[model samples]
Target: MSESTLTSGAPITQLPDDYMQNPHEVHHMLRAEGPVREVRTPQGLKVWFVTRYDEVKTALTAPGISKKLMGRVRHDALTEHMVFMDPPHHTRLRKLVTKPFTARRVEALRPRVEEIAAELIAKLDDGDVVDLLDVFAVPLPVAVISELLGIPIDNRDEFRAWSNQLINVSTPDEVQAATSGMADLLYRHVREVQAAEPDDTFFSALVHATESGDRLTTEELVSMAFLLLVAGHETTVNLIGNAVFQLLRNPDQLQVLKDRPELIPASTDEFLRLEGSINIASFRYTTEPLELGGVTVPAGELLMVSLLAANRDPERYEDPDRLDVTRPVQGHLAFGHGIHFCLGAPLARLEFDVALTQLLARFPNLELAAEPETLVWRDSTLVRGLHTLPVRLA
Candidate 1:
């Protein structure tokens, strides 16, 4: 094993070289050792990695922990969103957009979501080997979110590239470039929407949305748009991708879903529990010294909650590693817990249900095109998904 020195001059353990490809083994080791372990991320940042389910919930909701960036990392347009804010600020920002993502609103979007999924699936042909991630997973959510936000569809490819760089383990330079590019594009788009007549689109409503006569500022709108556009699609993209990948790997589980299509909605939680999109929750820091999983972490230290690890914790679920579509999953940290729980959860679930239902019905014999061991996972601590999910649509 290798070590790296943090800015505090303390030695930190580096993650295994193959950590991204297969993190479960490492997570199993970490959970057994203890809930919290200090380690260096693939990007070379040191963090207190929370592995077990119980400790993860504590880290997420503890009053002493903070989401405020506070200059710990470079601040830019991306940092302006509610995910980085705490309390009153987070509350206010979330309130403005909450109505649009409510269960009723999301359910109302079902037909449109189904239409988009069907349109994408129609492009594929039987007996064709294709990168499912590229042709299906990525575009479906991108199109849905783009239309909802009233953003033009012409720049989706650019949006995907920028979002990938921002979400993945990129250097400061890469992140800055992506941040600048996305900020520029969204700023212009937001301005266009702001100047136009009020409309029913979510972005327009957000621009015109008022809570007690309060509205999002220009910078805030850009940041919120950035969050919605990127996160709005990214999570669902991986959710669909990971679900299909897991189903392909486990034939028995796949057959269960094929035989009982009604299980698809319930299976969404199982897929999320097994391999939800985001690996680690976003960056969080300690406000003061606090005990986490019996380990005392100092103030001003970085902490990361492993959503991926927490969901598969043996103590939390029986046979956690096994992919059982019928498993009753509840309180999984896949969508996170507490105030920062994903606002897009409802939409993501709806999209998964539509995507998988149409997908399986249209291509009942779908199978993986590549060997299981050969697939590559994205090199990202924040996002957990594949670089490509090659599959045969038969």
Candidate 2:
């Protein structure tokens, strides 16, 4: 490994390629050694990487840490989402939008979600190879979000294109341009909806909140819209893609699911645990000097809990490498933990359940078109997913 350039103690800044490809090995090392370790970024930022399961649970619930540390460390223009906020403010912000993400709300969309799944499946031509990620996985979530938010059918493509640019790691200027473009789109769309009569949709709800005594600022509304578009779709897209890839990799397990469909819900959790979409926990900054697992992380420092690493820690899970669809998964940080737990968990679960159930039932003989090793992984430090999932419905 390269010489430790940033933090004290063992060399930790640079994560090995294997860590990105499959971090189980390094995670084992962390569990055996310690939970919280001082790591340095290539940019020389001193950050803490929480590795063990219990330690992560504590850190996630710990006071004085949150997703609101944006611009404090890296002043990126893409940090407008509510995921980057702390308590009272975060709670207030979340309340305005929480209703739409509740289980009942997501469940109410079942008919539409099932219809979208069927529509996508119906479009598949027999014996033709398809990039499932692009055609099936990606569009499903975007369409669902568009329908729920009442985004005009014509505007969905623009929202998607802008969201992709905003999330993809690009140059500062490019990131800024993407963020500005997304903000402009959301501001304009919300304003137009507000100027007109309110409709029965999420954007309308936010407008109603504003019209009432809720007091949601224009910037906050835009930020929430940005969050729904990016975080809402981006993570679910990865989850569906990852779960499909895992099932295909283990045809026996796939056959089992195909044979017995009742296991879809339980299998979804296992799929998330084995092939979690969000690799990194949302960003958190220390409010005070915090010591975890014997390492001291100073106040006002940036820290990233590796959900990818934590879930695979041998101390918490047995046979961490195995992808048994039947395995009972608990305490999985896939959706996250604590007050900042994913608000869209219910909706995500519904999408996965509906999408996966239909996907397997429709294309029972689905197989990867390319070798597993040949498939390109998305080059993202934040999310774990493939750039493309090429498959053929056999």
Candidate 3:
């Protein structure tokens, strides 16, 4: 194994309070200092950081990097989804759910997504100053995913509570509790699903999905539901929330988008480029020793890419730090790359586009209700998002 140039215990991506509020500083540091660097995590384990766009893109699809578990990590963490698998198994698991998440299926939900976004706006009308994350950004995506999966609408509150802890938990105890609780709840829901006759719901389709005589086992089915319910909405929750946060913070951009409402879809791409919900891809174990960004990454070592840093690399984007909704924003690694590219990108884009458009149309005078300094962010290593976005509508 090659030794790292970084000093022992030096931090990689995890940073101070200010950096949490504005991570572009860290991204700048990553870009200016070392595109391929190493540092100790809060957990004290050292890992390689790929901070440049070209290097990150190459590493994402590298043959020597496999997404399958290669260490002491628990399987319960993946929730039995394809996001954690290498191909053949990953391909099989992803195939069962691919048709349901195709562009057509997501497009079919756009009208309903509009309905949900509008309803959420109407509900927020009672309060002049409100937390948009609570009333709009969070619920709109959850509602869409829940409805898509045919989950009963009444269970949303409970589902959201469990889902939040799983995605943003800040402690080890919270992780154990959230993991065990979600596993139990989803398993029970799966049993309930299997005990009944099938229907046209996505959950039912997953339960019955077969290919060349292959079918999802009960464990796999539950894991699939758990993955969809969490990943399906979590990333989009941040996607929409982060987008609205960006537009509101950048008034010039906000007014531009408001005047040209059709730009909302394109704006989502810019927002993803800026503050993508997923900061790092799932862990990839090296299949063979590889050279990455001038450093030798030994075989079997765990590696992670900083999508946050990569998307902001000045070498990859002109004026990369500026938030331009109209920038030609393709090729950003917001939804990731390679065989594991996000299955829900179409759904997420549609939801954000609808939500931002309806929000701007309904409250043309919307403004921030809280000081940007006081806003809190979820303390997550793999995702970047605000905990709440308070706004005023007039």
Candidate 4:
């Protein structure tokens, strides 16, 4: 469909303000306009924003299209993992990486994860205001990923800082600079670990895979490690931060969790649905002409799926705007759909469940230190989350 077909009030390239505050209005507009509409990023990349649930499903799992197109389209820095690959290659790489992220594997770190959270909470002054993001959200995921990858505790801070800089959507130059620094760090760290001949860690496991008949290239290993380290924690940090922010905004829901801890698991799902951290889908390219939402996407066009919009699609969920703590939002696209679904989803859920449960139990009197509108959010079209969530521990 032509750009003019949609409302002239809605710009073709830039994301509208309604998308930031209440995206349902824009989703309704796009859905009414049709499923696949011509949109462009601020960078001026022409893309088809998939709005409807059924159309998003089709685009994500559609044949002919491959995740590998990411490298083809923009091969500047993000040159790693099955996240940018498709089918056989994606399948193989995902299998190699998935071995260590299994429920048993991730759950094995529960005690350590809880210890980290407890330590963080202990540092907060009782009845004193604190930024949940600084005190909890950011560190929890960094610690978990660092421990899993055998990164030295001393280096954890550096890693987290670099990851944030690398994924900074507000500025492309910062992302590029972070990419270069991360690449340099990756090589140095890989060499250091190789020389040390460390015990069984995720990095060591990857080294073993490379040495074995599996034969992963050195470049591939480096890229894979970077991908895992960055992608591993970024989304989860936002998820935890977003959950705490939402709960603080709605004290009734916080009390609900405080009263019945059993709801932690279900509430985690609902939080992801309502304010799911990962807001935007990765760029998907069309392999051939395909009909969707009454528009045909010719071969080789880029498709940008709005995961945030799809999660709030009225057709999929009743009263999509309301945040019902008890709602069963199991099928939400927060972690995405199909083969490219998040591999670390289970671990993220576990972290949120444990962190929030323990957090509320520790500080039942928690409240926002500042108004919700005052809280600053990370301004990136890719991932959506708050930069800081000020709160009072009282």
Candidate 5:
């Protein structure tokens, strides 16, 4: 830890532009100082940022640290979702959707995911510079999740438009409008499905779901659908994009995976650890005053673990900054930890493993078409992905 950095808090806004392209450097600076520090989000909310790996694992499951910040959060649609709820509520909601999101169910989509990737890659036959994020990474997950959830194929663009607004904090109108629109759509769908008999589709599954005896209410159902549909694809889209970006930069590692295509699974985890999609875990507040990472964080104050930072913590993984595709990544927090661990992890991993392998195989000489310095990154404190990845597949 440096003496000067200890005195001056690291401002999230003033982080170097390189931090946007690759945030691990900024994360390294914060982790070097200590495990946890205070900072203001782009939204101007003062919050404690948890940076170390061990501390993050502990904080994620801390009883005093909770996700139930009822009135504190502005977005009500997201409020009733499992990610935002504490225990009983979250547990109940999760159980209903767990059946469809199980490992077996996700694996069943293997052929479908592979087919989707192959179909998308087949379109890139024009040997020209194309934005992979647009033609590949972005569409693949949206299509897969929408299919799994029985969301109409026609709704993908609206979902993306609304979801983009929902995830980014810059556009309050967009976020609000998106949330409101999703609420109506999900609620209406739930009711429509419930009015008739249910099917095996995710929409029908939730509409008729019963856990031990209790069922998700209209509000809870609406919120769950919104969260699942948005989160289902958003992170994976970034996962696919981030993996390609890292591998393109580290050609040796890329070739290692290319030669042994079996290594794409491990490489997915490496990318999650090295350049994870989420900027930070969603909001958690201290349920009661408690000591964390040597700091006495008072109750009701906002707290979050930098998922990307913890994954890169030197204390947890050796050469954490380097991208090693063959490295073991069994317990990485990219899918998070504790009761709130991502339910869609199975699906996300399946998507990444399938998409990356197919894309690499399809474009044997794939490389960044643009200079690295000229790349544009999406501006969101919560997501880490290139806005567009221009690549040459020839």
Candidate 6:
């Protein structure tokens, strides 16, 4: 798993220990060698890793590739949601929740989102050294999603713990525990929503959502809730954390943002391109022999698209590694592409805009409390984010 192994052109057996901390070096090598490479994930699952931008896009939308997990039973309630399904089923589940996250509906939430950011920032004193993820990044989106879904935020810490375990846990026992805890908590909430009168909240709507006389079953309701709960906040948490971390590392970029705060919204995509929350899109399997990037992947092999890698492909961007907040980053695959594009992209963008604006306005002298190299990233290929972000709020 050393860097030299990547240079040898032999298939990568396992990812380096620091892959989560920084994957671009490996991405660069793989992109240069070929468009696709066979690699065993840190989890020991072999997959056809799609690296180059064009091929990644093709793999994302290819008819021969399937989103459904092959030869495995549904592991938990979370597995039943849209991210793991193909069309018709994915279409149905996604349609039921799409209206609530539309651009107009999300824009209407701007004021509330601002208020949430302000309230959270208000609690931190200028001189205090705090783990920004816990104090700011993690809670803001959790609150927004909780309120939107009409779920109680009183147990947010527990929610955060459940999310962390489910995303990063390496062992089956841990995964089972996290899955059970999330399923139990969400099932109770879904039942409560079902008992109450239909309301405007997203969860309530899902509980009562209908399309052409078809309604979500109880299991489907709970599973959908689980997906929204996790997907809603997870991306924003890392987006905010990673953006701040990058700005701190690049002081000039930080100053530029502080001086011209109007650029905050536009910079969201740039941040996403540099350090998106999800490293790899969810799992896919080939339904038939497929040609991607001149490589023929056999039928039924596991497939994964490296979004972080594709965003930095030299063939695509003029300067892929540099952090320039003003750069035009329109077509980035951070929120993914095609029909499986993130349902919460609008909300995630709105949150990033508000969070960064309020944060820089309040503390212009923010800096990392720990050495840059000392910060630990979460140990999950599915998520690319720090375990904590310690910052001096000056």
Which prediction has the highest lDDT against the true structure?
1
Which residues of candidate 5, in runs, are more than 4 Å off? 1-22, 153-155
Please give, for residues 1-394, the per-residue lDDT of candidate 3 as tens digits: 1233445444345444444556667667767767676654545566777789988998888889887662246666335678778778888988888855667666888888888887788776734888888888878888888778766547676676667676663576876777787777667777787888988776777787788888888888778877888888888889978887777789999999889998888778889998899887777778898787787788988787888888988888898878999998879998899898988888888888888888888888888888787888876667788888999886
Measured by TM-score, how close is model 4 to the native structure? 0.90
Compose the digit string of candidate 4's lDDT tens values, residues 1-394: 2243335474463446435555556667887778877775545566788988788888878896767775764574348677888878877777777765567877877898899899998898787877788778888888888677766547666666677775555366766777777788777766776677646666677665532356455676678777777777887888888888887777788788888988998888888887788766877788889888778888987888888778878888898877779887768888889999988888888888889888888888888889887776775556778878888887
Alpha-carbon RMSD, candidate 2: 2.4
Tens digits of per-residue lDDT for model 1 on 119-154? Answer: 888899999999998998899999889888878868
Cα lDDT, model 3, residue 293: 73
Preferred candidate (lDDT higher): 2 or 6: 6
Model 2: per-residue lDDT, tens digit, 201-221? 666866666423575666776
Candidate 5 C-alpha error for residue 97, in Å:
2.0
Model with the higher TM-score, candidate 4 or 5: 5
Candidate 6 on 1-394: residue-level lDDT in tens? 5422445465564666667767888788788879988887665667788999999989999999888882264566778888888888889888876755667778988999999999999899989999999999999999999888877867887788788888884567877877898888888898898899997766776788787888888888888888888999999999999999999999999999999999999999899988888888988989999998789988998888999999989788878899999998878999889889998898999999999999999999999999999999898888899988999999
Residue-level lDDT for 57 in candidate 3: 93
Which ten contiguous residues of candidate 6 have the minimum total lDDT?
2-11
Flag clash pairs in model 1: none
- Screening candidate 4 with a backbone cut-off below 3 angstroms (N, C-alpha, C), the clashing residue pairs are 67-84, 365-394
RMSD, each candidate, Å?
2.0, 2.4, 3.1, 3.2, 3.0, 2.5
